[model samples]
Target: MSVLGSLTPLPAADHPELLAEPVVKALSRLPDASGVLVAEIDPDLADTAAFCEAYSSPPEFSANCVVVSGKRSGEVRYAACLVLATTRADVNGVVKRRLDVRKASFAPMDEAVELTGMEYGGITPLGLPEGWPLLIAPEVAAAEAVVVGSGIRGSKLAVPGAVLTALPGAEVVEDLARPA
Candidate 1:
């Protein structure tokens, strides 16, 4: 893969090149995740737009992971959703219904980063908390390959769409994302 800069292709399961505990732990549990590739990045350019622009990776080849939360039975439930960079997660509609909550919104940045042990812009589905559903847009799950966060802003991961769909608790949803 032609990455923007020097990217060390590290194994996704071990992810020794990655420093986030939750990310490493989560990846290790995926039996078919061995093909995922992890690469280092300039933390300042970790956001999807900047990373894609600087690295020349088309937006269609990148996927973004977002955390959302809402109250279900008076208890807060959080879920991670994945969508292509060309689209946005349907938080209020698809996400809310899937979460079984009256309303759903993106989790507060601080809460999401702290709870997931990931940087704000680098939160990924590979290492989310247990019981949290990982909703992926069908378009993203059908792509041959995608670039995603590595839990920390300093790095990113590249893996096949099938690998993401195979992760524990991952659910492929139609219209999960809306055009950006």
Candidate 2:
């Protein structure tokens, strides 16, 4: 009788009080947030295609959020949220340029966890720390809906595509992502 019956368990939604502090704080800011979904899965898993297939979700529905560091300061900041299995965030171009950083690179696992308060494979744009830019690819926005991480390694959250764009501090950009 779960909201996502026979699919997966979303820890955040199931135990909202147990969520990481940053996630809790972020969710507090987004009162309209539809809520996050968690699924049970292996932590070592990295392939989005296989993950989607196992979850019975369309590959295109996955939103991949990539964290990048600042160019000059090399500070761990900014994140690009794009659709998985179809498009890759233009990290060096649109993402870097949009952040106004002279250089940018993928954020390390530890750093991603520290800043977002979520596990390496479970970070979602919905409950990210405040001020971290959440850039959405135009194509992702165009989609009718999307599936995002549920703040825990074992789940995913299905939400309206427009809802992703509506999150506080989210920026909808064109060509932010390209086919992988």
Per-prediction TM-score: 0.92, 0.80
Candidate with the greatest TM-score versus the true structure: 1
Model 1 agreement with the true structure over 1-180: per-residue lDDT tens digits: 544234556776665566578878876677766778888778999999999887777778889999999998889998899999989999999999999999999999999988888888888888788788999999889888789998888988887889889887899999899999
Global lDDT scores for all candidate models: 0.85, 0.67
lDDT at position 112, candidate 1: 95
lDDT score for residue 59 of model 1: 78
Clash totals for all models, in order? 0, 7
Q: Pick the candidate with the highest lDDT.
A: 1
Regions more than 4 Å wrong, model 2:
1-21, 34-47, 73-77
**Candidate 2: tens digits of C-alpha lDDT, residues 81-102:** 6655577888888878887888
TM-score of 2: 0.80
Clashing pairs in 2: 9-38, 10-38, 38-155, 39-154, 39-155, 40-154, 71-103
